[model samples]
Target: MDLLEEYRRATMFFESGDPGGAARLLEPIVAAEPENASVRQLLARAYFASAQLVRAEEQLRALLEIDPSDHYAHHVLGRTLERQGRPEEALGSLRIAAAMRPDNDDYRAALRRVEARTGGRPR
Candidate 1:
């Protein structure tokens, strides 16, 4: 299979609002290129957008293992946990993302919302 063309197809699917389709297309690409951060990140996002929180969390966590400095992975992991109703578990990742990208309003907002939810003091 032409992975690059497939990746483009997946990207188009994601952009067209068919996250599940994008995810299906991306799964094989990710399996073939486990270390491809861009592919993994997009797959993670597709899972998240499709409400597959567990899968999203797994992919996001793997992304972090590949690059712990990935603020977006941290943020999305926090979001996945939050969506799973595990606000307490979400706090650590949210905090890390917020700290890593202090200029990111979305990341800071996610942190604040989770902190408010869990009654945790801001970090």
Candidate 2:
């Protein structure tokens, strides 16, 4: 299949709660298009949903390196870190995401949750 077709199928699989399938479809795409932020983000999300926290973290961190101002990358990285039991690391990313996009409820909520876990202190 073409890259676009594979991407569409992967997105369908992810939306249908079959993140493993999405990850399978997305892996090659990511390898082939490492600079494609959208594809990388989707792959990271797929990895995260499938409980592959390490892969998700790697992808998210790479995405952040490509675009440090990417709020979504920060948000996902924060969630991935939190899932990996690294609340202190997660708090920084979550706070950056929330501060970058104050109107994003999801980012704010994540920041709040992480803050609560870290003694409700703004670090």
Candidate 3:
């Protein structure tokens, strides 16, 4: 199998709003190249868009392990936690993302919203 071709196809599916399809296509690619951050990140995004929050969180965490400086991974992890109804748990990641990229309105907004919802404390 041409992993690059498969990755491109998965990206197309993701961009076309077929996240579940993307996730399905990406699963094998991820398995074949477990250390590929780009493939894993796209898989994580597909999982998140498909509402497979747990899987998304897992992939995002792995990405973090690979590169702690990944602000986008932190942001996505925060969003995944928030979607899972764990606003308090989301705070740390959101804060990190916002701090790392203070210019990102979305990251800052997410951090602020979660802080407000959780009263700036974990539940």
Candidate 4:
């Protein structure tokens, strides 16, 4: 099957609340396509959903290193940071995502929430 098909299967599993299955499905794809930002991002999402916060953070960090302009990576990184009780760091990452896609309400809302928690502007 094509990569897209595999990715879709993983996404379906993730959306169905089966993150472990999704991660299992995506892990090899992620390893094979280390530079595929979308796969990395999806794998990170699966990791997060599975409560593997550290792994999610690591994947998102790698994604950002590969493409600084990847708003999704910034957003996910912010989420992971927030979950880790680091609101300041979350704000910094969320702000990058928000700046990259100013029209996205989810990104804007996340940025605002992080800013409020950190008692500072979205960094």
**Local accuracy of candidate 1 as per-residue lDDT tens digits, 24-117:** 9999999999999999999999999999999999999999999999999999999999999999999999999999999999999999999999
Query: In model 3, which regions exceed 4 Å deviation?
Result: none
Location of the lowest summed lDDT over 10 successive residues in candidate 3: 114-123
Q: How well does each candidate superpose onto the true structure, as a TM-score? A: 0.97, 0.94, 0.97, 0.88
CA shift of 65, model 2, Å: 1.1
lDDT of each: 0.96, 0.93, 0.96, 0.88
Index of the highest-TM-score prediction: 3
Q: Report residue 30 deviation for candidate 2 (angstroms).
A: 0.8
RMSD of each: 1.7, 1.5, 0.8, 2.1
Q: Please estimate how well model 2 matches the true structure, expressed as its whole-model Cα lDDT.
A: 0.93
- lDDT for 120 in candidate 2 is 56
User: Candidate 4, residues 1-123: lDDT per residue as tens digits?
Assistant: 477789899999989999989998888898888999888888999999888999999999999899988898899899998998888878888888999999999999988888878787443
Give the C-alpha lDDT of model 4: 0.88
Worst 10 residues of 1 by lDDT: 114-123
Q: What is the lDDT of residue 89 in candidate 1?
A: 93
Q: Where is the poorest 10-residue window by lDDT in model 2?
A: 114-123
Q: What is the lDDT of residue 11 in candidate 3?
A: 95
